[model samples]
Target: MTTAGGRPPRRLRADARDNRDQLLAAARAEFTEQGTHASLNKIAQRAGVGAGTLYRHFPTLAALLAALIGDDVDALCATGRDLMTHPDPDEALAVWLHAVAVHATAMRGLVATQMAALRDRRTAGALAACHDAIRAAGVALLDRAHHHGSAPAHVDIADLLTLVNAAAWASEQAPDDAALLARLLALITAGLRA
Candidate 1:
């Protein structure tokens, strides 16, 4: 089938599709246990596929992460879209940012990889697309907030995302603190208000 870009999408054979699915499942488990730096070979072995097969399916760590987290990113963007109709723009933004942070924390070391993908134009195609979706979502939320005058005119979407990512990273470092993310978000939003 042709994609929106007019390029025909590659269709895998049934066996290849099975192998890819297994690799993705194994990669998800390994990434959850060992963060983004999980061993590719280990994932391949766990999937009962060779390293070559894994490489064929996912050429890079960023590609693997992008495949694994693509659905979550879509959901986050959907949530952002839903919040556009919220009664309070500031609260909608705050809530959406919190959701973004929570999504980052859920994937353990995802924030760093996502931030890197945002900076690197040469990242895997899927990763780049995910970052684009995230950026668009953030921009939409920020636009809503700014239009309502709840956010300062100078508030930058990139800066807000970076702050949320940093908070998620900090929360990961302090895994024992159940409320660090919330506390950090509170401080961040307070600073925005100031």
Candidate 2:
């Protein structure tokens, strides 16, 4: 089966596959609980695998995070596909932007990792593919909204994404104040409307 980015799955032996899967599961838990700074050794221990095995599978924290979040990006693309069919273009764009914000802030420090991966040449291909997929999704939504004349002609997809990213970053800082985030997003959405 192909992975999230349509890359062919690595042909791993049964034991190796098991190790990789365990490592991913453990890493997800550890990262979620401790942020991106979580210890790799603890992750390896949690997975019941040796440090060597973890290193063999994922040489760097960025690689592990990229693998883990690729699935989320794919799901975001699926959300965009579904939003395309919604009857109201403006509402669809608004909802999709909200989804993007949620995805960005789902894990602490994910936005930073994503930004880093976008800049780092070595890991850029996979992460850029995911980023581009999300941008394409946003572009589709923006086009629909523009065609419907609900969104301002001056609005650009990249600008919209940047706005959402900023809101997501704010949400990360004050996670308990979800109402504030919603209000801020609503204000931004309102500004986009014609």
Candidate 3:
């Protein structure tokens, strides 16, 4: 298979592919438990691989983060797809927005990592692709709500995402307080309604 630029996909040897998968799995677990600043050496150790092997697979932390966040964005988009079949457009939008907020704040410092990735030139392109996918899903939900007269016609996808990010930031600040996160999301949902 070829990529969008028409370059053939680089196929890894079976062992190399296993190593890469292990590194990604270890990195995900470490990042989730210890945040973005988690030690790379520890991740390598958890994966039962040498530090050099980890570096060989992912030369930079940003590269590793991009892969992790990209997977998350895919899952979030899938959630949006599943929500589309709901009877109420407003409810679907609300549920999807809440899911995005949860995903954005899933790990300690994840929002910060995402913001940094979005700004870093080396990682920006990959992150932007993921963000664009997410935005497309958000647009679908927003348009549905607008068509049903549940959301304001003037509201756009960006507006809803901004609110979602804010809620995610707030949730990060009070990670132990699920009620607080729920309340904040509820307020945002109410505000988005027509």
Report, for all candidates in order, the number of backbone clashes.
0, 0, 0
TM-scores of the candidates are: 0.92, 0.85, 0.84
* CA lDDT of every candidate: 0.85, 0.83, 0.82
Off by over 4 Å in 2: 1-10, 116-123
Model 2 lDDT per residue over 1-194, tens place: 89999999879899999999999999888877877568999999999999999999998766777787889888989999999999999999999998888887756766445654575557656567777889999999999999984898789997888888888778778868868668879988999873
All candidates: CA RMSD (Å): 1.9, 3.2, 2.5
Q: Candidate 1's C-alpha lDDT?
A: 0.85
Q: Lowest-scoring 10 consecutive residues by lDDT in candidate 2?
A: 111-120
**Candidate 2 Cα lDDT to native:** 0.83
Candidate 3 displacement at residue 76 in angstroms: 1.6
Per-residue accuracy of model 1 over 8-64 as CA lDDT, tens digit each = 997899999999899989988887788866899999999999999999888888788
Candidate 3: segments with Cα more than 4 A from true spot: 4-7, 115-122
Task: Judging by lDDT, tell me the better candidate of 1 and 3.
Answer: 1
The per-residue C-alpha lDDT of model 1 at residue 180 equals 95
